[model samples]
Target: MLGARAWLGRVLLLPRAGEETRMAQSPAPIPCQPTTCSSSMGHKDWMDKCVCLLTAFSEHMRRVPVALPEMVHAFSAQQQTLKQIVICGDRQAKDTKALVRCVHSVYIPNKVLILADGDPLSFLSCQLPFLSTLRRLEDQATAYVCENQACSMPITDPCELRKLLHP
Candidate 1:
């Protein structure tokens, strides 16, 4: 999603080690050399240089330049406003199917929706890092909406789910 101007700036600002070495020797500009071209280099040398460049670029783009805690803090900050919905039930139950269908019909931006048929506790703990505690499903089909570490009352009906989502 980089703009053309930003991309051009990166291309221009990229440090050229060969250019730097040549510049330090003399003030006069040197003619372009074919030996500097990748096509003119040996296949093994070209491949090695390509790998080095890719590794350096990827390292530069990583969010954590130093430590794991910094990366976790950055990720948490990015997800602070995220809203989550968990639909829990037996997978083959009619009520669970109805709830899934109802949920799919609605669209909410930045909302993380999970359909859990197995152990709800394990699923919630793994997917939702901000939730300290999760309530167990009481019915054959149920749903919960959580935001800012707070959860709404468990809903058992699909119609109630639609209302809660739209409201």
Candidate 2:
């Protein structure tokens, strides 16, 4: 794994500080907007941070911006396990069930599509618990996809969500 300093540097971009005071005085690094971590932190760190951040956001939905708790709760309540994901709006892809269900395609808006495939790099980046719960189920062995918490899978067409769920 890359060193934290390198990772932090790449993420923050500001020069290293000579003192702890400087570190504290520095403004909280704005959430890495534009998802530039791909270029600086390299692919692994970028993906890890994405998952970690999304996961944290999902776990703490009330504190994060643009998160939907009800959606997350509903997703978690489902007894079915998911494998794939399909992202739509800025907060659309935040579902975990899709990833677990091995969803084949995602319909993402231009605004939220960040990674090379318009998918969140990590499950931790999820701000919604539904997505977070699904992500928590994901591992090297299972395929998963998400954005915020709304997730479903067993789909072949981007416009075929109607086939997957009763919504």
Candidate 3:
């Protein structure tokens, strides 16, 4: 299990321009360490779970508005370079996990707002008003990639998500 310092250090090492400023202005990183899961789970599984938890925690930390203006200034400085990739998927679906792992592997959280929820349509509609028309499109798991507010066709295959994110 990685310590908070180690996880924060790794996040800091990423090539985000004003990330340091944002981190300074935001609340401290979550102090919790990754706890071991079931013994049957592989190391990769444990690590993935840890990463997801940390990502969620970091997102929560960013909600503080104490230094909103400064944070916005810092974020705007890098806005042109960062692509706001909003990924939406059903949180309970197996394919949603796959899509999340794919996005995390390729894009930095600083560059993308990856939003995954069991009710993605409701979640995204509230977060991104432009996606009010977006829907799950069936019971099966699906993913939608919206770059800078322009959404692509809903994707049902994880491989297609990888291609869309990387390409």
Backbone clashes, each candidate: 0, 37, 2
In the range 61-127, model 3's lDDT, one tens digit per residue, is 4667543443343334233333444445566567667767777778543354555454535654554
Report every candidate's CA lDDT: 0.51, 0.34, 0.49
**What's the candidate order when arranged by decreasing TM-score?**
1, 3, 2
- State the lDDT of candidate 1 residue by residue for 97-120, as single tens digits: 898888788876446666665563
The whole-model C-alpha lDDT of candidate 2 against the native structure comes to: 0.34
Stretches of candidate 2 off by over 4 Å are 1-9, 13-34, 39-42, 63-167
Candidate 3: pairs in clash: 91-117, 91-118
Q: Candidate 2 clash total?
A: 37
In model 3, which runs have C-alpha deviations exceeding 4 angstroms? 1-82, 108-110, 116-124
TM-scores of the candidates are: 0.45, 0.23, 0.45
- Give the Å error, residue 87, model 3: 4.0
lDDT top scorer: 1
Model 2 lDDT per residue over 1-167, tens place: 12222234245533234423332433222224313334221245554554455455554455442334332432332212322243332232434334323233443221122122224555433522233233222221222243233434423333344344323
Top candidate by TM-score? 1
